[model samples]
Target: MLLATINSSIVLISLPAIFRGIHLDPLEPGNVSYLLWMIMGFLVVSAVLVVLLGRLGDIYGRVRMYNLGFLVFALSSVLLSVDPFDQGAGAMWLIVLRVVQGVGGAMIFANSAAILTDAFPAHQRGMALGINNVAAVAGSFLGLVIGGLVAEWDWRAVFWISVPIAIAGTVWGYRSLHELGSRRTSSMDWWGNLTFAVGLTALLVAITYGIQPYGDHATGWTNPWVVAGLVGGIGLLIAFVLVEQRVEDPMFSMHLFAIRPFAAGNLASLLAATSRGGLQFMLIIWLQGIWLPLHGYDYESTPLWAGIYLLPLTVGFLVAGPVAGRLSDRYGARLFATVGLVLVAGTFIGFLLIPVDFDYWVFALLLLVNGLASGLFAAPNATMIMNSVPADQRGAASGMRGTFMNSGSALSIGLFFSLMVAGLASSLPGSLRSGLTAQGVPSDVAGQVADLPPVGSLFASFLGYNPIQTLLEPTGTLDSLSADHATTLTGKTFFPQLISGPFHDGLVVVFLAAAVMSLIAAAASALGGAKYVHQED
Candidate 1:
């Protein structure tokens, strides 16, 4: 699980180097599709497959499927490290391979919790799952530093590092882990599975693209294709629900929703995961794009240093996760999970109050609070979810829980990104135009530059490129300008200083939305009722 999550996050931190290695400019309008695919493909595939895969684990041996996952993950890591093309083809190769890797990830994620639940008693599930949850949250944080350090040398190393871990885990699992869970022999619900997979995939893929610019519009939410996808996907999902009801052996046991703890816990899980994903992306952009540069970190070093500085967050999670999990075991999950989410909501409010170029200590303090709160919520919430289901349904329930969480993360990249982009759009153009003009850029060139989508600037900053350089180099504006003016325009401080206000405005919008989601998650957690052990059938 640690390896799976670490691999996911490594890709996030190593993206700039990865894109460069593949000879793709992520900021290029035409290439944004590639960028979005690179990020979304793995997530979309995992979200779509985990529920089905979990059912497979229940039908077959959980350990068998898990072993296959390890082997597949190792092979995919090898292929990713040895990507053999450049430019668009290279991007496509990585994307396709990542989807395959996500297949492996789904297998592991879908079954791991169920296996653990089967092996441990109900009273101890929270502690065990809490430790597991720590692997997830902490691994994501650790991957940032690992990817940053290795990507500083070679981007391929990021993928390479996963190989040994996959191999070791595969061997160990095969050697030590056994299938302790009850296996259900049932016919496949091919129709239910197909509709669920295809419908969810279409819905998520549409969400990924809906945030991109469409013609003259700020977002593609109104694009005819997007609208079609939305309606079609929702229609298909409705059909899937209907199909599940009549099936002899439904892949997704919709009856699980009747369990108040299971249903409300999933609702809380989804919203909390969405907030968590959005916070990670938003903070990365804030640090890599603006804050780190302002603090005198070089563009080339920001990715690594951004990860390093965020360690306090990991520290808080590490300190809080296991202890909270153990505490939840004795005290029951409801109070802990609800209070944890409340704390997380309060921290998001803290984010809204902070400045874009915030002091390091203040920023670190906010992150620590967020991390502690999240850790408190994750394990206990996950335990409640896995414990609420019958023994026979545990695998499916774990998969369902994972689906909600992973899907939420996938949706966050789109939903929060759109909110942040829309917020920036209201003020970024004017800021860009005036800032460039003030720096001795030709007004015509400045206007033209400002006219381009703000995503480019946002991405340029994320990739640790000077936004002025990225925007002007293709236009010959840099060549036409005076040396002093060009130097001033391309300096790190210039772009960070210019974008700070607009970025802050965007942060306000994003964090407030996250806070609202967190609060709602708290309400959902509260509705999950007092803890009670599921009686195994």
Candidate 2:
């Protein structure tokens, strides 16, 4: 689980290095889709396939499916590290392999919880799942730190690190683990699987492209294809629900949602996951794009430092998660889960209060609090949902839970980026034009640079690239400027200062929305009612 989840995010911090190694410029207007896919393809595939894969696990054996997943993961990691092409083709190779990797990841995600539930008694399941869940969630954050350290040595090393771990896991799981969970004798729901996969894929793909500029607009939301994807995706998903109702052996057990704890816990999980995912991106951009650079870190080094500095957040999770999980076992998950989300909501409001260039201690404190709150919520919520379902449906329930959380992470990239991009678009062009022209750039050159989509600039910053350098170099404007002007334009502080106001505008909306979501999650968590475990006689 750790290896799978770690690989999911290891690529994020190492992307600049990976792109450089592939000789692909991700910020180029024509190549932006490649960049988006690089980040999202694995997530989208995992989100779409987990339920189907989990259902497969139930039909077959979870250990069998899980063992197969580790083998797939091991092979895909090797393929990812050894790309035989460059430029767009190289990017395509990596993206395709990543989707394969997502398949392996989905398998692990779908069965890990059900396997644990089978292995542990009810009294001990909370602590066991809590520890496991922490590793699952914390691995994403740890990937940032690990990716930065490894990428500094070699870009391919990012994928290479996973090989031995996956191979070891495969062997160990095959030898040591056996199927303890209940299995159903049923055929596959081909229609349910097809509709769900296509529908979800279309929706996520549309969301991925929605942040890019389209036909003079700041975003692709109005694009014909994107519109078609949205409409079609939603239509098919509705069909999926209908089909599930009729199918004797449905891929998704819609009836499981009739259980209050399962339904409400999933709702809270989805909202919390979305907010958590958004927070990760926002913090990375905050550090890599603005805070770290303004504080004198170089663009190329921001990814590493950003990861290191966020250790407090990881620590908070490590400390609180198991404790919360253990306590929830004795008491009820309802109180802990609800209180945790309320705290999570408070922390988001705390973030809104901080300045763009915030004091380190203040930022770290808030991050720590946020992490603690998240840890407090995650295990109990997961335990509550998993426990509420019948033993026979545990695999599907785990998959459904995984689907919501994974899908929420996928959706957050689009939702938050769109909100942030919209905020940047409103005033960024004027700021860029004026800032550049004042620094001795020609008016036409400055206008052209400013007129470029704000998404490019945002991505540049997010990827730890010098935004001014990237924008001005293409126009050959920096060569024309005096050394002083060039130096000021490319220096750490200039772009961060220029963009901070607009960035703050976006931050306000993003963080406020996150806080609201957390509150609603808390409400949902409360609605989950008292702790009640389902027992099948």
Candidate 3:
């Protein structure tokens, strides 16, 4: 679980280095798809496949699928490290292999919880799953720190470092683990799988493209292809639900929704995961794009420092997760999970109160509380959801849980980015044009730069590049300016200061939305009822 999540996020912090290593410019017009794919492909594949893979685990053996996952992950990591191509092909190689790695990730995600449930008694499941959930959630943050340190030394090392751990895990898992869960022999739901995959893929792919600029629009939401994808994807998913009802063996057991704990828990899980994922992206941009640079850190070093600074968030999770899980075991998940989400919402409101260039201690304190709130919610939520299902269906339940979480993360990219871009669209161009023209840039050049889609500037900042330099260099605008003007145009303070106001405008929308979602999740958690475990018939 740790390896799967760590691998998922490590690539995010390491992207600038990885693209540089592959001789690709991520901010280029033609190369943006490559950048988006490098980030989204794994997530989409994992989200699409977890349910099917988990069902396979139930049919075959959880340990077998899990061991296989480790092996596949290890091999893909090796392939990723030894890229023999450059430019598009190199990016393609990584993307394709990363998809393969996502398969492994899906396998692990689907079965890890089932395996633990089988190993532990019901009374102990919360504490055991709590520790597991902590590793699962906290590992994403840990990967940031690890990726920053390793990618600075060598981009290839980012993938290479996972090899040894995966290999050791594979061997140990194969030798030491055995199937303890009841196996259900069943036919594969080919039609159900097909619809689910194709439908979910279309929806997620649409989301991937929806954040890009479309003609005169700030985002691709108006693009014909994106619109078709959305409509088509939703249509297919509706068909999938219908098909699952008629199928002899469904990949997703829709009947499980009849269980209150399972249904409400999943609803809460989806919303919470979406909000959490949005928070992660927003924080990275907040730190890397604005706060760090404003505080005198170079763009090149922001990734590392951003991760290091987020340690307080990770610490809060570590401190709260296991304890929450154990307490939930005794007192039931309802109180803990509801209170935690309420705290999460409060923290989001707290974030809305701070300035972009916030005091470090204040920001860190918010991050810590958010982390603690999340940890308090996660294990108990997972325990509640998993415990609600019959023993024979644990694998499918685990997969269903994972699907909501992974899909939420995938959706966050589109949802939050669209919101941010819209906010930027309203203010960024005017700011850019005025900021540039005042610094001696030609009016035409300044206008052209400002006219470019705000997404490019956002991506540049996200990738830890100087947004001003990226925008001005190709236009030859800087070369025509006075030395001081040129220096100020590309300097750290100028762009950060210019964008902060618009960025804050966007953050207000994003964080408020997240807070509302958290409150809704709390309500859903409350509806999950008292700690009642499913009794086998």
Candidate 4:
């Protein structure tokens, strides 16, 4: 779980380095697809396959499957580090390998909880799962720090770090981890798995691409392919529901939803995961693009510092998660989960009210509070989810929960990103154009740069690179300008100051949306009633 979560997060902070290593400019209009694929493919694949893999673990043996996951994850990590191609091929190699790694990630995510539940008695499950959950969630934050620090030296080191961890885990798991969980006799639900995978993939891919510019529009929401993907994906999902209802052996037990705690826990998990995912994205961009640069960090160095600055979030999660779970076990999951999400929502509001270039202490405090809230919510909610389902169905329940959470996280990239992009589009063009012209860029050149979608510019900053110099390079205006003007134009603070207002506008939209999501999650969390542990049938 630590390895999976770490790998999942490290890539994010290391993305700019990875792109550079591959000789690919992810900010290029033509290469945005690679950027999206690099980030989204792992998440999408994991979301799509976890349920099926969990069912497989139930039918076969979880330990066997988990061991295989370690093997696969390790092998893929090695491949990821060894890409020989450059440019498009290099990016494709990494993206494809990430999908394979996601396969391994799905296996680990689907079965890890169920295995722990089987190993621990009901009385101890919450504490045990709490520790496990902290490792999973905390690793995400830690990975950012690790990625930033390591990628400063070698981008391949980001992937390489996973190799030794995977090897150790594979050997340890195969040797010591027994199938403490039940191995059932159900046959594979091939049809159900197929439809669900294909359908969900199409829907998410559509959402992913829908944020990109197309047809001279700020977003591709109206593109024909996206439209077909959305519609077709929905139709297939409907078919999947019908098929699951009819199938004697199903990939996911929809009947789990009849259990109020299970249903509510999952709904809350999805909402919270979406908000949490968006929070991570927005925070990184906020720190790298605006805060760090404003504070005198170089564009090329912001990624590392952004991660370092966010350590308070990880520290808060570590401090609160297990303690909350232990308390929840004594009290009830509902109270902790509900209160935690409300805290999260409150923190989001706090973020919304802050200025673009706020004080570090204020930002750090909010991040810590949000992290604590997430910690408080995560363990209790997860415990409730596991405790609500029957023993025989725990694997599927875990898988279903994993699917919901992972899918929500995946979808967040599209949802919040589109919202942010929309917010930026409203004012960024003029802001960018006028800002550039004032800096001695020709009007035509400035206009051309401004017309490009803000997503690329935003990503360039988020990735710790300045697009101002790159954008002007195409205009051939750098040579025409005096050295003083060129230096001033491409200086570290120039782009950050130029885009601060527009970025803040987008941040308000994104952060507010995240707060609403947390509120909804809180409401759903409240619906789970009190703590009631399930007994094996």
Candidate 5:
């Protein structure tokens, strides 16, 4: 489980190096979408399939499916490590393999909780789950450090690093992890599977496309295809719910939600995930784009530095996770879960207080607090949800929990990016116009250039490209500027300096949204009540 968690996070830190290795620019207009998808596609696919796979595990054998997951995950890692193509083709290959990897991940994610629940006695389940849940969250933060280190040395090493660990896990799981749960001889829920998959895939695709520009607008939300996806997918889901109510064996057992703890725990998990998942990316951008650049780090070095600077977050999680889990085992989850969310809300406010280029020590301390808050919430919430389900139903319930969590993460990426980009679009052009006009450029050209879509600028900063070069290259005005003026215009420092005001505006909006969501999550967690259900001995 630890190794799996490690692999999940390690990729995030190594993305810049990975792009360089494939002879691709992460900021190139055509590649920006690919880069975002590559980072997120594995998560999306895993979120969508876990429920189906979990149901399969219940019908077949948990150990059998889990062992197979290790094998598949290992094979995909090898494929990813030895990626043969260069340029766009290589990037495409990586995306495809990543989806395959998600398959393995789904199997593992779907069953790990059920396997643990089967192995641990009821009294010890919280501690065991706490350790497991912490590994998952810890992996997310640790990925930054590992990614930064491995990517700095060699990008392929990041993927290769997973190979040996995966091999060992596969062997160990097969030999030692036994099937302790009963298998149901139920038929597969084909209708439930089809509707759920198609519905979810459509909705996620709509969200993904929503972040890209559509026609003259900065976002694709109004596009016919995107609207269709959103509407059609939702319609299918509505139909799926109706179908599930009638099915003899439904993929998502709707009745499960009738249990207060299970339902409330999942709702809180989704909201918490939505608030937190997208935050990591926003924080990375905040560090890499504004803070690191202003603090003397070159754009090329910002990715690694951002990861390094964020180490305190991982430390906080490590400190809080197991202890919270142990405490929850003795006391009910309501107190810890509610308090943890309150702390998370506090962390968001803390983030709002600091300037983008604030002192590192202060920033790190806030991040540590955030991590601790999240750790406090995670284990107990997960334990509460799993405890409420029947032992045979744990796999499906866990998968459902994962789906909500990962989907919220994916959705958060879209929501935060959209909000930030919209904020950028509103203020960036005017800021750019003023800055360029001050530098003696013509008002007409400056205004025309400023009015260009903000997506390019957002992508430029995101991929560590110099936004000024991209902004100026298309106008053909760079050739006309004197060498000194052109240097000033295209230098690394120019665009970050220009867009800081607008960027901060967008960041505040994102933070506020996250804070509100966290508060809601805290409320929901509290509503889950004090009841704990343990299957009869």
Candidate 6:
């Protein structure tokens, strides 16, 4: 579980190196979509399939499915590590392998808790779950550090590093982990699976594409394909619900929502996850794009430093996760879960107060506080949900839980990026035009260039590329500028300096939106009320 979780997170930190290694600019027009999809496709696929795969575990054996997951995951890691293509082909291969890896991830995610539930008694379940959940959450932040380190040496090393660990985990789990849970002897819920998978895949794909510019607009929301995907996906999901209700053995047990604890816990989890999912990416971009660049770090080195700077956040999570879990085991989960979310909301507010170029110590401390709050919320909330289900339903329940969490993550990515892009769109062009014109660029050229979609700036910042160079290249303006002027324009200092104000303005919107969502999540957590520990009927 630790190894799998770590690998899942490590990719985010390595993205810059990976893009460079593949000789692709993540910020290139039309390329941002691919970059976003590559980063997010693993999560989307995992979210969509977890429920279906979890039901499979219920029918088949959880241990067998989990073991298979390890093998598939390991194989995909090998494929990603040894990717032979360069440029677009390489990016495609990575995305494809990542999707395959998500399949493996779904198996592990769906079964891990059910396996633990089968092994641990009810009283000890909270403690065990807390440890597992903490590892999973911590692994994400840990991935940032590991990815930075490995990617510094070689981008492929990020994927390579996972292989041996996965092999060991596969062997260990196969040898030691036994199937102790009840298995249902029922047919697969084929219709439910098909509808749910297709619907979710379409919706997430739409969201992924919607973050990219389309037909001269700042975003793709108005694109016919995106609109169709969103609408069509929702329709299918609605149909899936109807199918599940009619089916004897459903992929996701609709009746599970009847339990107040399960229903409310899942809702709160979705809300919390939605609020939290895109946060790490946003923070990473903020650090790498604006803060690090301003603080004497080269754009190329920003990715690595961003990871290092954020270490305090991980520290907080490591400190708080197990401790909160243990406390929740003794007391009910409500106090911890509710308080944790409130703290998260406070952290968002704290973020809003910090200037874009604030001191490192202040940013680090705030991140640590945020991590602590997240850790406090994660374990207890998860335990509450898991404990509410029947023994035989644990696999499916875990899958449903994962589906909501991962889907929230996907949705959050879309929402955060959309909001940030919108905010940037409003202010960035004017800033760019003014800044470029001040540097003696022709007003007409600058105006045309500024009018380009703000998604470009977001992607440029994310990829550690100099936006000025990208902007000037197509216009033949770079060749026209004097040596000194061109040098100044393309230099590390100019682009970041130019974009800071507009970026901060955009970030305010994103952060405040996150803060609002976090508040709603806190309210949902409060509504979930006390944790209910279940026994066999």
Clashing residue pairs in all predictions, respectively, total 0, 0, 0, 0, 1, 0
lDDT tens digits, residue span 367-416, model 3:
99998999999999999999899988999999989999999999999999
- Give me the displacement of residue 336 in model 1, in angstroms: 0.6
Clashes in model 2: which pairs? none
TM-score of each: 0.98, 0.99, 0.99, 0.98, 0.96, 0.97
**Which candidate number would show the highest lDDT if scored against the true structure?**
3
Q: Model 4: runs farther than 4 Å from truth? A: none
Q: On a 0 to 100 scale, what is the lDDT of residue 359 in model 2? A: 90
Where is the poorest 10-residue window by lDDT in model 2? Answer: 1-10
Say which prediction, candidate 2 or candidate 6, comes out ahead on lDDT: 2
Query: How accurate locally, in lDDT, is each candidate?
Result: 0.89, 0.92, 0.93, 0.88, 0.84, 0.84
Model 4: how far residue 230 lies from native, Å:
1.6
lDDT of 6 by residue, 50-165 (tens): 88788888889888889989999999999998999999999999999999999999999988888888888766777788888878877877887788788889999999988998
Q: For candidate 5, write residues 1-537 as lDDT tens digits.
A: 666667766776677678889999766667877887887788789889989988888889888888899999999999998999998999998889989988998888888988888888777888889989888887777777777778878888988887897899899998898899867778788999999999988998888888888888988899999999999989998988999999998887899999989999999999999999767878888877777777777877777787788888888888888888889888978899999999999999898888766888899899999989998999889889988998778888888988898888888988898999888888998899998987767789899878877767766665565677767777788898888888888766677688788988998899899999999999999999994975656
lDDT of candidate 5 at residue 164, scale 0 to 100: 92
Candidate 1 structure quality by residue, lDDT tens digits, 1-537: 999899998998889899999998888888989988888888999899889989999999788888899999999999999999999999999999999999999999999999989999887888999999999889888999999999989999999999999999999999999889988989999999988888998899889889888888777888898888878888889999999999999998899999998999999999999999999888888998898888888888888888888898898888888888888888888998999999999999988887787888998998898889888898889888888888878778889998999999999998998898898999999999998888788899889999887877777776678888989998898887788888888877888898999999988999999999999999999999998678954
TM-score of 3: 0.99
Runs in model 6 deviating more than 4 A are: none
> In model 1, where is the ten-residue run with the lowest total lDDT?
455-464
Model 6 is weakest, by summed lDDT over 10 consecutive residues, at 25-34
TM-score for candidate 4: 0.98
Which stretches of candidate 3 lie above 4 Å from their native place? none
